[model samples]
Target: MKITALETLRTDEFANVLWVRVHTDAGVIGLGETFYGAGAVEAHIHDTLAMRLLGRNPLHIEAIHREMLNLPMAQSSTGVEHRAASAIDIALWDVFGKICGQPVHQMLGGLCRDKQRIYNTCAGYRYVRSNNIKPVSNWNLEGNEGPYEDLVGFMTRADGVAESLLESGISAMKIWPFDPAAQENQGLYISAEQMKKAIEPFEKIRKAVGDRMEIMVEFHSLWNLPAAMQIARALEPYKPTWYEDPIRMNSPQALAEYAASTNVWVCASETLGTRYAYKEYLDRGAAHVVMADLCWTGGLTEGRKIAAMAETYHRPFAPHDCIGPVGFIAAIHASFSQPNTLIQESVRAFYTGWYNELVTTMPVIKDGYVYPMEGPGLGVELLPAVFERTDLTVRRSSL
Candidate 1:
């Protein structure tokens, strides 16, 4: 069947709004979630990409993806363009799966494992319980800021939050304490002492949790090579699971150099999109763990392809998840289909409420493992009325 229409639903969840939607035809429809900043990707999809998607063969996922890539979106056919393409690509795979009467994972090479390993990203409750660190209201995934005197109290709340996550069967956790003081102003430069203080909680979390759980330090591309290297060395003794996004996403040469210099295995590529972009990272051996977000890397269609490519190189992949249920389930389908998956990321905040509101019949996570849903396609059906109730605006981009 030919493509009929593409739709997007943008909702205000977490600090910023995220985009999710489905592509429909007369017979079958596919679901996808776009990975982008607040108002960025939804506008791109609704405005320009949606028009191009109409009347094309929705099953021609690879061809459609390549057509979108030829457009000069963001810069050099990368950023926002890939995000829009990813949404469409994912939906196409969903349609493909439904047409064949199988889950997307089954279509992607079948299941390599019965369940996927997951780590809790919601450490607010856990951190507070175990370390006496109280997190601020709505920890925006961008870290926090307060008076120097408030550091002790914050640590206390954080300890408890960390403990809670571990108690909740989270064997590993991720924290985006880019820097305690630099939260409000991400571009603000800080002294070396301040940086040390920022990572101190992680060191404390390690001491508290010991080997009970793995801790991942998220830098959010906040440091230059020198600063990132310095911080990497400082945290080496603690033996973190990985140092994520130590530097920016540009220049594979620079990324490889920095990764080679540190004992910490550099984890990058949440921003990088598609198997095309992933090739550079793999060719350079820039990362030990390639963090590919199926939502951003062209959904299950391309996500499974990228993961398979990394597997050939003997590198493990960790699918990034910070968006809604669509992205989360899409990542699971892609991860379960690949044998090289390391661990998947999950935001407890998003999954708790927002994800529940979007779909029905999803996988259940128990004891840090996600059991695959035994339904067709992505295995979750979107509630159209819920989509309407959420009150998301589908704005068109000028492009």
Candidate 2:
């Protein structure tokens, strides 16, 4: 069956996350969600890539992915073009799974294990609520409740936060206490005082939980090589899961140098666009673990390829999911299908909070592990009430 229409829907209530609906000549319609820049990604979907998808077989996911990126302006980058293609590819995969009467993870390759382990990225309810991604210093969101509170608490109360996640049966947690310094210093340098302040949480977590919990430090790609190297070397004693995106991902040579400077493994960026970008990081030995955001890295079609490529290099693959609900579920599908996958990222703030407000299916995370998602396609859809919100915006293109 061919695509009859492509439509984008958004609500200011959710702000930055946009949903796409791919209508087929058959009765089924597939759903996809993408995070960041809803307005720009929406325009790219309709004005730039919709024509290429309008009459195509919805099951030709790879070909359609290429067609969407074949335009000279769209090629070889992970910008708006790839983001638009990613959402469409996810929708098409939903269609493919529906056609085969299977869940997306089953369609990918069937589950390799009963469940996958996960790590929580400490973030507040209001984190990434807008298109602008500058790090936030304040944790004072209006809805900071007792059971579900701790946006920036990872820094101030590392011990309490660790205890809380352990209570949920989650054993791994990720935090980025050094980012506010990078933002202030332009990633150029971290003074001794700043370095001491940043290491406080690491010290606290190590003191509180000992080796019972796995801690991952996120640099948010907000440091220069010198500062990143200094931070990386300083944290080697704590033994973080990996120093993630410590510096920018623009150059593999610099990252390789930083990786060589310390024993700590480097987990590279999820902001990269395509497999070629990941290849550069891999071939250069810049990163020990390769990460991809399925939503931004050309969806599951491309995420699967990246996973295989990481396998070829003997590197563990991890899918990034600090985005919307549908993308979070899509990442879990990719995580289960790939044999080399190490773990997946999730935020209790997102999963236990806003994620429920937008979608029907919530991933099963308990005892520090996430079970393979059940049901056909992505196993989730926009809540029907989402469409009725007064702040919604929609645009459509048809064959």
Top-TM-score candidate index: 2
> What lDDT would candidate 1 get against the real structure?
0.69
Cα error of candidate 1 at position 258, Å:
1.6
Model 1: per-residue lDDT, tens digit, 292-388?
A: 8766666676777788888888899899886567878888887888899998887665555456656775578877788886777888777675657
> Candidate 2 residues 16-112, lDDT tens each?
7888999999978899878888899999999888877899999988788889878888755668888888898899899888888899999999998
Deviating ranges (above 4 Å) for candidate 1: 12-25, 37-40, 74-78, 123-158, 181-192, 394-399
* Residue ranges of candidate 2 with Cα displaced over 4 Å: 137-146
What TM-score would each prediction reach against the true structure?
0.84, 0.97
